[model samples]
Target: MSNSQQQYPFYFKSTIILFGISLVCYALFVLSDILAPIAFSLVIAILLNPMVTKLQKRGVNKIVAISLAIGLAFLIVAGIIYFITNQIVNFGDNLPQLKLKFNENLANVQQWLNTHLNITIAKQQKLANEALNSSQALLGRTVGGALGILSLIFLIPIYVFLLLYYKTLIINFFHEVFAEENSAKVSEVLGATKAAIQSYMVGLLLEALVVAVLNSVALMIIGLDYAILIGVIGALLNMLPYIGGIIAIALPVILASVTKDGYSTQLAVVISYIVIQFVDNNFLVPFLVSSRVKINAFFSVLVVLLGGALWGISGMFLSIPFVAILKIIFDRLPEMKPWGKLLGDEVPTRHKGEIWQRKRLRQEASNPEKEKSL
Candidate 1:
């Protein structure tokens, strides 16, 4: 019998792999509430690990060290929350005037439509009412989302504490799970994954802070209302990768359209945000977060959208880290190194099916170190 017929067929293996992936995606959506918090906690825990280790080396008890690290992280998060909510309170105080401005703008827009399109005033009023209702509904949803996020915040610290406390247990569990010869590989994967997640999260926070400052200054100079709040939000959203950047750009533009009188103000907002994004993409990301994870643009967008689809906002945030961990594991295994390369951004040789390129590919496949160097 031919090898294809005598052994498990490639199609059969492919089918199983496809099924496994679908099952995983479905499970992610189903168990998001349980998994998302844990995933987030793991990232925070990894970032805090070095501090905890330092304290441990200085003769602090593990629990004490972990607690101190978690406490510091909590304070940082709480400070950010306070900063945002303080702005939100100020925004609430201005609601009456903001609403008045919105109504005047809406009426002027309705009038313009009536004059330009020969639309009746009554029909325009109906459309305005519908829009107002939709806006209210959107506001309600936003409030709900905020509450959900606050709940997640409460759960995350507990998870981080537990993860940090059980750090050795987890390592021992891995050692027990993997075969004896693979112990070194397991440690390597763990160390690399921790470093990657830690760097990515810290770098992301630094990038966001810088971007927020720039955005706030630009918007303030443009004399936009609630400029600080909008700028901070845009910077935070920019952390979410592809889907987020669109939302970030759209939000400031929309705010400018409603509050600022002239089209020029809105145009300025657009131009400023575009320039800031240019700086962020070209300089800030490369300097800060890009090196650690290094997933290609295609997979970054794909996983982000998939994450949003499966686990909502938490999924979107967690996807890149999760992919990085996967790539680390894949790279550590000989059979899976190709899959790791698939997720990565590195493109050493571009042309397809060229003789030299094919030779390089074969060499890299045979020698994983060469592939990494390339």
Candidate 2:
């Protein structure tokens, strides 16, 4: 048998690989609740590592440094929640007036539909009733999602603390996994992974802050209520790759349409968000986040959609970092370098055949005598 066949029959190997991938995916889906917070905690721990190191360098105890780092992270998150909660309370107080206005608009729209398309109010009511029939299940889903978020809030901190406290042990265990001869390569991979993830987290935080500021300023100028709240929320949502950007734009536009008068304010809000996104994509991302992950847009979108399909919103948020980690590993292994290359945004090189053809063309161009002989 040829060497290729001796290694493994291509079809059999391909089937085994596919099966293994499927099994891994199913396991992830099954254990998502347990795994999600762990994944989140790992990212947070990595982010806080710099602060811990700085404190240790200053002669602070390791436990004290970790505690301080976690406390700081908690305060930042709590501040965001405080703003959001106050806005929500104010919004709740105005809900009755908003509902009254919404009913008036609905009546106007129903009348217009009747006049233009001869659709009766009765028919419209029936259609709405049909929609309301599914509201119970929708409400259940909403409650479940809220409960999941609550769990994350409670679980994530504990996980992060344990991970930070045991970080040295984890690093040593990782080193021990590889042969002593490969210690240098293992350490290199670990260092690169740490730097990439740390940079990624910092870049994302800076991007979100900038986006929130721009959004708040624009919305305030446009005379929108809760401008700060909406802007911050939108920025947080926009952290999710492909899907978040669309929702970020749509959300403010919807709120403006419902709460504000005329199309001008709505249009301005949309235009402002678009401009923010344009600048973010062209400038902020390239300068901050792009180098750290180096993932191609196509695969990023693909993983995001798959994540959403498999694990809902949490998956969407987690997918990119997981993919980046995988890419880091792939790049570190010689046999897996091609897979890493596939995930990257680097420009393609000419094939050997194309290179040979180009060389022949160049030679002919350089030598008229050789060309004539050919």
Candidate 3:
């Protein structure tokens, strides 16, 4: 048998293995609707671990700490729900005015199109009517869909509470299952995983808060109606990464174009969103998240899109950290290190020559008597 023939079989096996892994990942994506809530709960549990630890240090029992953390989380969630509900109610009361303003803007757009092109007013009106009809159906579906989503929201806190309470038991079980020699390595990996998830969650929350406050204040200063609602939406969407900034800007611009008296206000809203995103990406995330999850831009975009495909908006929001965790595990395995390297931003430096040179120098530096003794 030739050497090349032997190598061909190895390459073919490796290809098969990769294909199998991809198939499994695709299946997981299809099932992500069921898994997303569980994933979200795990992320929350990691985020709250520090608080749980502090509470335990203060002599509180594990169950009590977990319960208290869950209670606080529920209260925070309730407050947000209360605020959003009030906003929706106020917006509902002003819907007629909003619709009128929207129609006025639509007229302006139609006028611009007529002036710029050879389109007839009748054709434009027909198009507008069709669009309005479609929008009504879409809005009805969206409202109905939201009720179903609200039902699922209750599951998150319960999942989080159970995860927190069982976290130690889970870790201990894993440690016991693994050989004693491998247990330390397993623990180290788990520790790193927890730290990465915690840092990501906290950093993201801080970024959202900063974006929300700055955006709301900027819009309020510009005298935009429903500035609070727009700001909150912007902050929430900003958690999704690259595409989120654009979505955040569009919402406010649409709102301004419809409700504001002038085009200048619409431009101002756009500029404010851009500035907030700039501050967030450049200044906020880097400092808050540290150098823990160093994913490259290409993979970042790919994972976010893949996540969006799998689980829609929630998947997109979770993709980066999810990929980061996978990368961490890949790096620890010898065969998967190359895949991990691909996911990382920085090119790892080759240390073979450096190590050889260092060893040579050390040998040269050693005394003759020491060398002879060795």
Best TM-score goes to which candidate? 2
lDDT of 2 by residue, 280-358 (tens): 9999988877446599999999998777655666677778888888898999899999999899888677666898999
Kindly list the per-residue Cα lDDT of model 3 for residues 278-323, writing each as its tens digit.
Answer: 8888999899756476899899889888776666666777789889
* Pairs that collide, model 1: none
From the highest lDDT down, the ranking of the candidates is 1, 2, 3
lDDT leader: 1
Off by over 4 Å in 2: 1-5, 103-151, 349-374
How many steric clashes does model 2 contain? Answer: 0
TM-score attained by model 3: 0.79
TM-score for each candidate, following the candidate numbering: 0.83, 0.84, 0.79
Candidates 2 and 3 compared: the better one by TM-score is 2
Clashing pairs for predicted structure model 3, backbone only = none
Q: How high is the lDDT of residue 130 in model 3?
A: 97
Best-to-worst order by TM-score is 2, 1, 3
